[model samples]
Target: DAGITQSPRHKVTETGTPVTLRCHQTENHRYMYWYRQDPGHGLRLIHYSYGVKDTDKGEVSDGYSVSRSKTEDFLLTLESATSSQTSVYFCAISLRVFDTEAFFGQGTRLTVV
Candidate 1:
């Protein structure tokens, strides 16, 4: 297996609440990413980490934040949940940022009313 798992597979929250999702991996890949899937947005990258304590914001990182303190864990947080932010979030791990196969977690489905 790719050794990727996500916590809180499903969540429902009121608008303006804070939500945090967790991703854990045992593969120890160098690159880890957070992605959000929606009807129109497709799969958009929210954030990614290259190494421990090394991370960067992605195209749709406006209301989201991510952190990586070790090789096996990545955390994603929505500062204030909103209906617009409701989507299926995924965690992926890859040996390279591009041109390589990436392993993805099952996904977390979140809905904000």
Candidate 2:
């Protein structure tokens, strides 16, 4: 199984503040992804990087950005947090083909008020 972990498993923040969440992987996978899981919405991709310095926005990329400077680390940043952004964020790593299942971290619970 792939090894992946996320930092700041739980966080609470005020509106208009900036927050960063970190993801680290030991599997040396070629693809990394950040997603948010909300009730009734399933998991929506926030951002993903195929390779170092090569990232692209996902369906819900607004109010969020990501960076992957090294193969082992990926970071997600919220420039200005908001209540609507409060949700559980997950990090995943995939080296397998598209049909194969990816591995996910425990997740980070973020709450904004």
Candidate 3:
């Protein structure tokens, strides 16, 4: 989401628990994306939505799910968290048609035990 960063900037959870992260935007951007950051990987896309109910999986979509029911909100869900899923997550908003750079959230750090 634009302006606001990912919620719960830091979290730790046990393995196998369901986790939901939220992103909200004030600017009605057309494109929203979820991504994970890991050492050596920089950032890997998890999922993206161009409009409400219109979503597509990204490069690292496995074990993760996303939903966007409103223009200002996008959600990422981890059905069963694993150690491999412990990473910094980011939400980004883009205009798509314009040349402007995407606006990124501050990021959320999720640690699974």
Candidate 4:
């Protein structure tokens, strides 16, 4: 949590509005990820970046988009937020060459009304 930084750690917004969340890392890792936590689904990946300017969508990429313009920064955007989009968003970073565990940020709790 200390290594990774998330801006606007908590947020409240109206439906149909656009919102953006930021994640900053100091580890200089090559991989960064964005995820959302919900009750039944556990933790679902929203998007990820392998390197600067290289990003990919994850399983739950429908309403979310991501960008990584710098090695230590990743951003997740909600184009048009809805009530159903309210959830806790987390950012993770990993330096592993293969399959391994990743470090995560504290998380950003977002609520839409």
Encode model 1's per-residue lDDT on 1-113: one tens digit a residue.
89999999999999999999999999989999999998877899999999999999988999999889899999999999999998999999998867999999999999999
lDDT of each: 0.94, 0.95, 0.92, 0.93
Number of residue pairs clashing in candidate 1, backbone atoms closer than 3 angstroms, sequence gap of 3 or more or interchain: 0
Cα RMSD to the true fold for all candidates: 1.0, 1.0, 1.6, 1.2
Better of 2 and 4 by lDDT: 2
Model 3 accuracy (lDDT, Cα): 0.92
Q: Which stretches of candidate 4 lie over 4 Å from their true place?
A: none
Candidate 4 CA-lDDT value: 0.93
TM-score of each candidate structure, all chains considered together: 0.95, 0.96, 0.94, 0.94
Q: What is the lDDT of residue 78 in candidate 1?
A: 94
- Candidate 4 Cα deviation (angstroms), residue 108: 0.5
User: Model 4: per-residue lDDT, tens digit, 12-104?
Assistant: 999999999999999899999999999999999999999999999889999998899999999999999999999999999999637977999
Name the runs in model 3 displaced over 4 angstroms.
none
TM-score winner among the candidates?
A: 2
RMSD of 2: 1.0
- Stretches of candidate 2 exceeding 4 Å from the true structure: none
Candidate 2, 1-113: lDDT as tens digits: 56898999999999999999999999989899999999999999999999999999999999998999999999999999999999999999988648777899999999999
Indicate the TM-score of model 1.
Answer: 0.95
Give Cα distance to truth, residue 100, candidate 1, Å: 2.4
